[model samples]
Target: MSATALPAGHALRRPVLDDLPEVYRLLVAHDVSVLGFPDLTEDDLRDEFTEPGFDPVTDGWLALDADGVAVGYAWACRKGTSADVDIDFYVHPDADPGLGGCLLTVVERRAGEIGRELGHGRIRAMVGCYRVALGEAALLAERGYTVVTTFHRMRVTLDGDLADLADLADLAGPPVPSGVTVRVCGTDEDLLRAAHGVKEVAFRGHFGTVPQSFDEWYGHFAKRSSTDWSQVWYAEFDDEPAAMLLATNAFVETDNAGYVQALGVHPRARGKGLAKLLLRISFAEMSRRGRTSAMLGVDTNNASGALSLYESVGMRPVLEIDVWRKAITLG
Candidate 1:
């Protein structure tokens, strides 16, 4: 594509590592405008660019204003040629609305080419935006995408005396019924496998469940330098594993917050208070470490009443994100 083809007064170019600083700045601007906080970091952008499926050369683009300043950016990728592709794009508040659509058009076009290369007849493109991004929402809807689900960023302050940590140990609720015990994981391979198993079994029935092989799942966390393996926990009933909690310190270094990356209870263990026990365990541990808070994201309409459960434990919704999807077919 040439500058002449771009929306008038805008120029598009493929992104390179040299553009990281500019990209990061644009992202921060977008985040501050949309979330009132700079929720992104240079490391986050680096990780996304290095992710397994991302191809920087063909999968990302930067839009510059007439003055040659980057004002918008977009990227698209799929996991191992999967038909389902994830797309993300950001535009500076001062950019032309047409620039946003222009980048989105390029992203969708690249997604289609990727789907074809993967031997898929059609591609399912998924995108997310803050609920307050009304213009983006309308743009997506007008382009045939429909809202499929919503997620809430939940958080709770973790403040208590070290000696009182014991009392806060079970914020989720009372201990699992008799014959059940929960404990954090160590660096044992068997233990990691068991934790992954519990998560797989527990979330199989969840909405939009996409099954990832064990290696793929574990590899993801292993690659994240901020993940804390010790924060991973498992709940056992009568010596049989039944639930798991995989957490990370990703937010700790940036926001001074502990994060629950994944939490699940096996179907057979439902209603046993295991979920609540694991949650409180996290709160207690985070507080003991002197973290200011703990946070996690949950589906707003979760069939398992997860929203109510989190609220019951004093975690309030701090932000909302909506996922939209559109089908792409190319002749």
Candidate 2:
């Protein structure tokens, strides 16, 4: 595309590596409240592009301003699709709010090309904005996207001055109902594959359920992520996959934070206290890693009342966000 102008001193173009620090800054100043990844580092930025199995072309973008300034970028992947997929975007506050729509147009055009190349149907996108983030909220609202879902950014502070976990033993109410076991995983692919099976079941009726192959899961999950398997937790009962928690450390410039990107319990595992046990296990692991806090997100209307569960474990909702969506059936 050629150069174009917005209402004021604004324009939109592609981004480059120099935009890394700025992107990180924008995400930090805005994302922490409703999303995780509170901190980011140049290494993190570089890793995002170089992480073993990440396909940068399919997952990233560069946005520039009128003066050729790298303003912001919108990026996401095919989260899932049975004819529709969910994509995520990150826009800058100082950039033209109007750019959101233009970018969505860009996304549709680009994704269509991608889908055709790979052979697929319509592309579904999921975008969200915290009410506190007026720019983001306005951008999505103006883009012809409608609110479809909501989630909360939950956090648990590991304060040295705080009461001990032992004091919360009552909160630990029940064990894994006997014959159930939970443990950490190593670099074993088969075992990882097993854990993923549990994930498949756990995410069956999730907000966006796109058919994801195990190859896709392994390619993206283990390879693209900055995972420390030493930090991941998994649970099983009667030798069947029951629950799992996969966490990664934040590569941010500040704040020693650990993030549990995916946490779920198999439908059959519900009410067994596996989720909370795995959560406490995650909390203990984070403390061992010297992290002062840990965070995760839960859909506000989660069928399982997950937000309430997190709160019961001292992970309070620090922010709320609404997911806006436009079905791709328009074509």
Candidate 3:
């Protein structure tokens, strides 16, 4: 029945640039979401606070213990074309409650600043990939932030109906449909560059319209992934690049769970079953490797009927979850 002291268990407060390393370490330590995004390097931590258009001095804060060790951090910025949270942040393990509370205060403070600057009434705090992490998600949910939408961490089995994907095994694309050529891709530098190019084109207008820089794209996804270039494929019509399906396996410590990471096909080359074709390859290949199932995430509202396609392939939704969010108010 005793009152707890401030800055005791997990408190929040403004953070200096020096705390970047601790934040990065915290992210690496407890993230358990479906594998996405690159792990930030130690050197990258230094510029995290002020990277390009993001400056932590005014937009960031950290949660620290009485000993001044960082447990959690949060930062916010103005919303733009991407419809981002502007408020992005996280906390480390065994974070102090007092310190965590202070960090949330900073999140609110920055949210207000963004609202004022943008002349808007509401602000959003975007958390990247809400996995099993509690300190941040629980904190936000407690402060009236509910999950807004959800991106599925879905999976499907490879044993049943290999026909949908098997047909493409011998797919002999038309002889150079003018200037395009389709072939299984290699993990070489050139293919990586091509993969980057196609991704830029395909995702440019997709959901979360945030355009990623080449470095961000490479480091966060392509380069950072344990991508199996042998399994990657590219479609070229008339010998000109058009689409790709990038697949990789992240052998988690569990029994027999494999992941079908990315199943992207460029916009210009839609309607051709290229995705189904590539998925078949990945499925058959995964089955060959002693793995029983493959998993991939798809936007439920995707215009591409991605959910349907996945279901058609024996990949059903085992669970449904939402990304709830409550707008931050400056008034």
Candidate 4:
């Protein structure tokens, strides 16, 4: 890939694996400036660079100052089972305003190329950022993007006292309803298929739903070097799996926290309290592993009453992430 000319004092070039430290530094600095703490971890950066369907050499770009320090970074990856692409970029607080729009323009064009390569007739460019990221929100709006949805980054402390520990231990017996049982996924092929099937059923009709084969879904997870399949659990009611909770250490690795990558309850099992059961079980397991907190992101308008459920379980909103989308038109 050839370098792209940027502002007079900066140059844009393809990002390589070795650029992760500098890229992550820029991302965290931007994140902390907006959210009061770092949101992107080194592992997150690494995964983005190596995820399937994306070639860093062509899809990633970094804006560097004359001194060679990265001041901005952008990349796009195809969303599973769709012609849409998700683009994420971060600019240092000190970077030129023009750099933000420049990076976005490049990624948007790449998204269109990705769409055509995937044999899609139309494509969408989607992005997300903390609500506090006013500069990005304004830039997106100026560039014709619209706010499509909002998500809450919910969190809860797992460090419980003696009484709490006793309560959790009491729940260890059987957290689910009378006929339901919960267990971690097995490594066997059949068990993996069963777990993925439960996930597919549970997430149907959810916002931004994109159906993916088990291989694709698991492949994405496998890219995250820290993924622990043992933390992924499924709930079976009367010998039939009905719910799934996929957990990971992706975001909170340095914070000693656990993250719920996905939590879903089948429509048929909605009123059986399986969702809450899975959450409590996850919290207990995280605590057992010495994690001090648990975190997850959820759409504020989820049809499953997940917002209220999380609030009831002591999870509170720690950050607001807004999603913006616009159609892509290739030249």
TM-score of 4: 0.92
Q: Of models 3 and 4, which has the larger lDDT? A: 4
Residue-by-residue lDDT tens digits, candidate 2, 1-331: 3212233555544445666677677666446644554545656666666544234466566666667655556665454434444455555656665665555666656556555544666555666567576666676676667888888878878645446445233322234457788777777776677777888888778786654677877666565446677766678888878998888775323567678888889988798778888877777767766777878878887887788888887787776778887655433
Candidate that beats the other on TM-score, 1 or 2, i.e. the better one: 1
- Candidate 4 has an lDDT of 0.83
Worst 10 residues of 1 by lDDT: 160-169
TM-score of 2: 0.80
Q: Rank the candidates by lDDT, best first.
A: 4, 1, 2, 3
Clashing pairs in 2: 13-64, 14-62, 15-62, 39-252, 40-252, 80-210, 81-210, 85-124
TM-score per model over all chains: 0.90, 0.80, 0.62, 0.92
Question: lDDT per residue, candidate 3, 168-210, as tens digits?
Answer: 2332321234454556667466776776677777766655556
Q: Please identify model 2 stretches exceeding 4 Å from their true place.
A: 1-39, 47-61, 80-82, 86-97, 114-122, 160-177, 251-253
TM-score of 3: 0.62
Query: What C-alpha RMSD separates each model from the true structure?
Result: 3.3, 4.2, 6.5, 3.0
Candidate 3 ranges with C-alpha deviation above 4 Å: 1-101, 107-123, 128-146, 159-181, 213-215, 222-228, 238-240, 251-256, 318-321, 325-331
The lDDT of model 2 is 0.66
**lDDT score, residue 70, model 3?**
66
